[model samples]
Target: MSPENNPSSGIVSQLESWAKRNINPLFSKDTWITLGEYIGLGRPVSNRPITTARELGSFVSSRSSHVAQSALYGYLKTRAGTRFPELFENPKMLASINLAKWHIYIACISDLAAYMGVLLHLRTGSDNDKVVRLMSRVVDDIVDEIGMPDEAGDDFHESVEALKIRIENMDFSMHEDGDAVFSVSPDALYKWSPIADELKRFDRTPVKNSVRFRWKDVRETARNLFDAQAVIESFGEPGSSGSA
Candidate 1:
């Protein structure tokens, strides 16, 4: 397909829109539904949390079309006890349970979108690509809101610079066995853990960092944007969902 007519052009716009909308501090439930649709996973039609990890995993597994599958499954499985311990341990609190599930669904979609962007970057290894550039902006916006300490600035810049070098260096190489390889090593991607780690810290923080990170919906969205790449990579390349 011609670059201008590529389906990804539209998908990039949709992904950009979703990223921008979710970055807002005050998103409604309807906004959540729209974000879900952007990821090719429609919003939950009902108000109940999936009662078990297996069910939650299955629900996400059915909806996913990219590399974020395993990470989503693992996040849903552990989120109840870790992120929303009160709601997870006490199923009797129907209101809280419903709210927690709603948050989880939103988180799953954000993470799915964020990781998909990362994989697209890794696949093409191009900083100039529309999708990768959009994803990079999303990452920068999320981290900026999280408010990194001044002392952490150098480390952050160094890590980011290293990641850039790695991305630029990605190209075909000959193996000893005479095989041509055109991919990134998993470890190379793992170096990006600093960004993902900072995102998770914000995700799990009890104190509100920003209006964007204060709300459960946006917080989850930020966390997902910086989620670990290796885990997301485990599910393999989940090619694009096609035009919108």
Candidate 2:
């Protein structure tokens, strides 16, 4: 089937579209592969085989090289049109960096919405707290995956904790619509909703685009895992812990 007719490809297409229009117009083919490699979605040059989901997960969790990390930083900088050295030097100012990584995370989360939504539904207790945890995990996972300095983990944790506090202290009643507002700027607030809505759609409509998938076969494999995960979620089995 054509990518525009494929459900899986459709969601990714929407995410890419949103990112292109709002976050970064320059998030091109090279950017996608750079991100894939940065996040360990592509195989390393070592000829290591990632035959199973288990193997893929294991492979992704492993630390990447300094060069790969630098390349991703440069990519983000170019997209942002300015260098934000604080992204590497300080974790407390991440949101201030205002780069495309958050958009990428939200988009990726949207692409995984089918599996994530079901998993969220199956949770027994307060999902709000879990959402905060998930957000923290998102930051932690990216930090870990990028092979950030080990000593800086504490700073990362502190920054995320601060963000959580800001979230807890936010006033939802200030808005006429009664929607919870974050501490970020109006522009960020505007950008977040559509991405969240896209994430809320477990089944999404197709969109046409000429960009081709070229990040090795692992790119397609990663996309296919979303559908497989949805089927696995349908069985109502107990969910297991893993990273994205």
Candidate 3:
């Protein structure tokens, strides 16, 4: 059966559709103003929108990781009582769970970098050379902003480089529909899974399956969220400075 008709795929598609629609509101200046007010950051005196590549990078760095983590947590919590009943009972497995979280976090970052690379290319009308350089700067900003550990940081960089090469070779003409139509291939998704080592070492089948199964959904959701933010950043309100 086609993905749209399949039960599992339908649910995921619905969620993605909902998320894409809602993400626009989340990037609104008024949303940030209310967030700032609630968080005691105080209302900003100005609208500091994300315009430059570095700014977009920093924005993704701050937001993507958290979104990834939350996605994993929600997935696990949803499955804890059914597919992985042991998750709640086995406190000893917490370390493995945390490891999986970080692994997925880095992988999601890599995926987002590739998607953002494409977005930059299409939106800015930049060539591959400029796209790669801007993407590298974005990655650097993310790594520095997150203060990732040395080992994980290295892995993150390597993963991003590999994906960037794949993106560079892709037929971007397919993206005329815009960022929403862009998607990483299943092969690329499989290759990018960071949990293989964890799965081998932990012997926790439930956690392993959980990580693998939910990965594609998580990556797609992150892309949608980032695309929403990128839209606003690439072309702000009608008369704003960032608009095309």
Q: For residues 94-201, what per-residue lDDT tens digits would candidate 3 score against the true structure?
A: 444544445555555555566666665665565566555555555655656556444343455555455446544544334542333223322222333333454434
* Candidate of highest lDDT: 3
TM-scores of the models, in the order given? 0.23, 0.25, 0.47
RMSD, model 3, all Cα superposed? 14.4
Better of 1 and 2 by TM-score: 2
For candidate 1, give the lDDT: 0.34
Q: Write the per-residue lDDT of candidate 2 for residues 1-244, one digit (tens) a residue.
A: 9766654454445545645655533454444433333333333433354333333323333311222233234444443442232233344444333333333232232222212222333432224444334433433444455443343333444443444354344332233211112112222223322223444243122110100111123233433333333322232212545423
lDDT of each candidate versus the true structure: 0.34, 0.33, 0.46
Among residues 3 or more apart in sequence or in different chains, the pairs in candidate 3 whose N, CA or C atoms overlap within 3 Å are none
Better-scoring candidate (TM-score), 2 or 3: 3
> How well does candidate 1 match the true structure, expressed as C-alpha RMSD?
18.4
Q: What residue runs in model 1 are displaced by over 4 Å at the alpha carbon?
A: 1-92, 132-242
